[model samples]
Each structure stands twice: as C-alpha cells, then as structure tokens.
Target: MFSPTGEIVADAQRRGVGVGAFNVITVEHAEAIVTGAEAAGVAVILQISENAVRFHDGRLAPIAAAARCVAELSSVPVGLHLDHVESDELFDQAAANGFGSAMYDASKRDYEGNVAATAAAAQRGHAQGLWIESELGEVGGKDGAHAPGVRTDPGEAAAYVAATGVDALAVAVGSSHAMTTRDARLDHALIEQLREATPVPLVLHGSSGVGDDDLRKAVAAGIVKINIGTALNIAFTGAIRRELAVQTSVDPRRYLRPARDEMAATVTRALRVVTLL
Candidate 1:
C-alpha cells in the first residue's frame, strides 16, 4: 500500500530498523525499488534527487508520477521522497506532484542561512502534510565534494531540528557521497550521541560508502533513514554493460530488463540488511 513517508520512517524508528531510501533515476529504478521492497516485505522510500530532476530538464512531474504509481501498486508499503533539494520551488513542485516527503538542503549556506531557509521550507512542506528532512553543512561529500574530516555536532543538530521543525536530520559521521568503495569509517559513539541529542529520526546520507557491517552498526546506533544511490547505480550500470557485451540486440528493453532485475536484487539485499529481515 502507498504509505506516507513520515509513517514509514516512524515505523522504522519504532522497530529500531533502518528504512532504505533509494534514488530513482528512471522508471526502471522505481520499479526495481518497489519490487525489492515487496520481496523483502519492508517499507521503502523512493527518492527523487534534485540532480535527477535536472536530468529530466527540471520536470519532476513525469518521474514523480511514475514513482507514485509504483508505490500505489506495490504490495508492500512504499513512499516517495524528494532528496537533497536546494530550492523551495522544487520542493513545492514535488509536494504538488504527490511526494510524501522532501529533504531541503541548504547546507552550502552559512549556518543561520541554512537554518532560516530550511525552516521556511519545512513550514511549507508541513503545511502540505509532507515529512521534511534537512542536513547540516559539510556533511561529507555532497555532490562528490568530500571533506571526510567534517562531522555534524550533536548539539547543533538538535538546535537545527528545533529551529527548522524538520521530521528528520541527516548527519555526517564519516561517510562521503558517491563513494565506489564501502570503506568509510563511522563514529559509533557519535551516532549514539546524536540519537540521544536529536528528537527527530536521524538520517544517514552518503550511506553507499558505508560497508554492510558498518551499516548494521549505524542502525543499531540509531540511524533510521539510510540513503543509497551510487551503489544501486553501480549494480544497474554494470548489469547493462554485461548485457550489451553479450547481445547485439539494440532494443532498450533487452538491456534494461536485466539491469532492472539486477538493481532489484541489489535493493532486496540492502533492504534485508538494513531492516535486518
């Protein structure tokens, strides 16, 4: 059934499990994420990033519609989220298009600016009954720009949530974005501290760089929402590359079918691991 993002996230928090939020770049990605979630019998978040919206020339309706349709049809609970969006217009567009939640990212701005912008966006999002997420600045490798030394302050994270009224907060412990290797070291103690410090559910961005064992530890330490993009993309593109090498067929379905299945398998594994299913 189609679930509200807040409900899904709240359930994860209650169950002490991590909810996997997968980035959807295509219809196939949406289908795979939903199929994988159903297979795992766990609720999942289908995320549409700002860059992904730009990839479709700033038109999010088609992609959002596709994701909503997938969520509606899925046997397991599914929710749609807009991730790492820097603009209010994009957030509004997503909410108008039926996104159950959104992350308003103004992390590049000064602290006060980030708080002000995120607060406004959160207010607007809340008005539409959308769950809101935001991140602290320098949360490690935003858009492939890595500052591994950067870490979010638990006190500041608590303050940010109080000021912004967001439903979730994505913090940096050690992981960086777009990492092909799962070797990022996380601060387990710090994660526990953040969990105690913040009232809202905690989100872990750049989770693709975190290894399986580390991911489990992070969840145990209190990460509720885990955002994964690069790893799934890797699985999908690798499958496509292999399929094309074996067949001369120019049909996109011939290649995309296997790619979708491969991604589904990857998602299923991640869901099982994150949810401890």
Candidate 2:
C-alpha cells in the first residue's frame, strides 16, 4: 500500500528510525531510489526540486509522473515530494501533478513573511490530502549563504509549526546545502531541544554534508527525515564518468545502468546508517 508522507514518517520517528529523502533529478534517479527502498524494505521519499522543474521547462509532470509510477509499483512505501519549492505556482504544480508531499521553502523571506506564506501553503497542501514540510532558518552552503554557526531556536520552531500546521519541520542545526565535503557537524543538543518543542516530526536538510556517525546520532536524537542530494549525485555522476571514460562509444544505457546501480548501493548503505538498519 502507498502510505501517506505523514504516516510513514511519523511511524519511523516513533520507531527511532529515519527515512531517506533522495532528490530525483532524472527518471533513472527515481528508479534507483525506489529500487533501493524496496530492496531494503523501507519507505523512501522521491523529491523533485524547483530547479529540476525548470530543467524540464516549468512542467513537473514528466518527473512527477515517473515518481508516482515508481511509488505505485514499489513493494515498499514511497512518497513523491517537491523539495525547496519557492513559488506558489511550483507548489501548485507539484500538488496537481501527483506529488503526495511538498516542502515550501520561504526561508529566504523575512521571518513574518515566511510564516504567512508557509502557513498558507500548508493549508493548501493539507486540503489536497498532501503532507507539507517547511524549513526554518536557512540551510547554508548554497553560494556560501550558510555557515556552521546557523541554528534554529526551539521556541521559534514550535511557534512556526503551530502557526503553519505543517506536517513536518525542517530545521537548520548545522548542515549546509550543496556541500561537496562531509565536514559538517550537527548540534545534537539543538536536535533534542527542538524535538521536545515541536509536535511534528523534524527533518534535517543538507544531510549530504553530515557524516554517517553524526547522521545516526541525529536520528537517535529524533530527526525523522534526512534529505541527501549532493552525495548521491556525485556517486551517480562519478559512475557515469567512469563507464564513459573506459568505453567512449557506449550507449547511454550502458553508462546510466552502472550509474543507477552504483547510486542504489550508495542509497542502501546510507539508509542503513541513517535508519540504524
């Protein structure tokens, strides 16, 4: 059965486990994510971001459809989500195009505006039977906007979740977005505090920068969803590069298949680390 985002994520939280949110850049990525999840017998989230939609000419249907198809066929639970969507139109597009969940990122907006917009988006998403996740405090590392010093306040997080009625909250603890290295450290104390403050499951964005030991501790501290992108993308692209380098005249499938297989191996390993499997 296809479990809703809130249900699967909440269950994972209760079990002291974390679910992987893998960014789907192509149909191949989606396939690898779902395939790994089914093999592991764990629920997974397939995410498409605003940038991904733009890559497809503002239409999210193709990727969204592919994710939904994977979700439907997978033996394990899978949820299609829109990640870091900054516009109402993109949010609406994700909802309309078959995404079961979405994260409305207004983190760049002023605090009050972020609250209002995210709250409105939460209402809109819930009305469509979609789960909504919102971020607080910016995840740094994109163009150097975030540093290890960034953190979210427990009081503010509680208020944001209350005001927005979101299904989950993505809080900045210490990870930065788009980090090519794995030196980021999480604030385990902050994780415990935020977990105590908020009723909803907490999400950790920019997780690719977090080390495996730190990721396990974060989940142990109560983070239910961990979003990893850059790490897996690097693994996938590296495999493609390796295959193409050895056989320059090979078809795309010849290269892409190895990429997908390598990515699935990475996903499976990370899932074990994050979920304590």
Candidate 3:
C-alpha cells in the first residue's frame, strides 16, 4: 500500500531512525526503489523532482501514474514525494498526482521571501493534507555546499520551520548535488544543533555525496529524511556503460536490466545503512 510521508517520517522520528527518499526518474527507478525497500525491509519515499518533470517534457501524469502503480503494488510501504518544486503550478499537482509530500524550493529567494512563499504554499498543501518540506539555504554545488561557513544556523532553521510551517526541513551541512563521488564531510555538531532547535524532522539533501559512515553518523546526530539522487544515477549509468562495453545490443532491455539491478542494489544498501531497524 502507498504510505503517507508524514506518517512514515514521524514514525522514524519517534523511533530515532532515518528513511531514504530516493529520486525516481523512470518507472524503472520506482521499481528499483520498492525492490530495494523489500530487500531491506524498510519503508521509503519515491521522489519526483521538478527537473524530472521537465525532462518528461512538462508531463508528470505519465510518470506519476506509473509510480503510483509501482507503490501500490509494493509489499512494503512507499510514499510518493515531489521534490525541489518551485512553482505553485507544479506543487498544486501533488495531491492530484498521488504525492503525499512535497519539497518547495524557495532558497533562491531571500530569507523573508523564501519564508513567505513557503508559508503560503504550506498553507495550501496542508489544506490538501500534504506534508510540506523546504530548504533553509542553497544546497547547490560543491562551492556552496562544501563551504564550511555556508551552513544553516540552528536558530534560523528553527525560525524557518516555524515560519514556513513545513513538516520537514532540509539543511546544508556539507553535501553537494550531482556528485559522482561519495566523500562529502558533514558537520555532525551542526546537525545535532539543528535537530535540537527545530520542531520538525531534519532532512539531508545532496546525500548521494555522503558515504556510509557519514550517513550513519548523520542519522545518529539527527537526520530523519535523507535525499539521494546522484548515487542512483551513477549506478544506473555505470552499469549501462559497463554492459555496452562488454557487448553490442540495440535492445535497451539488454542494457537497462543490468542498470536497474545495479540501482536496486545501491538502494538496498542505502536503505539498510540509514534505517536503524
């Protein structure tokens, strides 16, 4: 059955565990996520990003319908999440599209502006029974993410969550997006501070750059929701590259099978590491 994001995260919070929210680009990605969850015996969230929507030529209904089917058929609980959403147009599609939660990205705006936009969106989403998530600052590339000085303040994060009324908050400790490498160092101290100060769950974005030890430590320090996208992409593409190198095949299924299996393996490992039980 499809799980609710708020219910799952709140359960994890109560149990002091972390849940992986992996990004899904295709129906295969959704399948791999659920396959991984079943292998790890954990509940998870399937994230569909704005970039993914754009990649599908501004059509979400197709992938959303496919993902909904995948989640509904899964043995373990699966929650649909809309990630890094910027516009009200897309965010409004959450409930209609079967997404239980959404991450509203207004970090491009100033603090006050971000608060206003997220607050309004949160209000609207709440009316539809959607769990809202937002980021404090820009968790963009290596430059901004790796800068030790450019971290979210504990007090400010608390203020942002209270002001926006988002059910969850993603903070930048030190992980960059789209990183093929998994060596990002996180500030455990700051994560603890943010967890202590904030009223809602703390999310770690750009988590694909974080390794197993850091992931474990981050969860211990207080990250309830971890977003992983690049790691799956890396695994998927690498498997395809290796398969093509070994054999010649025009049929995408020949290559895509290995890619999907590799991604499923990656997701299984991540889910096991982050989930305490």
Which regions of candidate 3 deviate over 4 angstroms? 142-145
Model 3 per-residue lDDT tens digits across residues 47-121 = 999999999999989999999899999999899999999978999999999999999999878889999999999
- TM-scores of all models? 0.97, 0.97, 0.97
Query: Least accurate stretch of 10 residues (summed lDDT) in model 1?
Result: 141-150
Where does model 1 exceed 4 Å of error? 142-145
lDDT of 2 by residue, 125-205 (tens): 888988999999878887575655457889999999999899899998999888888989899999999999999999999
- Model 1 TM-score, all chains together: 0.97
Please report the TM-score between candidate 2 and the true structure: 0.97
Clash counts per candidate, in order, are: 0, 1, 0
Could you tell me which 10 consecutive residues in candidate 3 have the lowest summed lDDT?
141-150
lDDT of each: 0.90, 0.88, 0.91
lDDT value for model 1: 0.90
Best by lDDT: 3
| Superposed Cα deviation of residue 100, candidate 3 (Å) | 0.4
Model 1 residue pairs with clashes: none
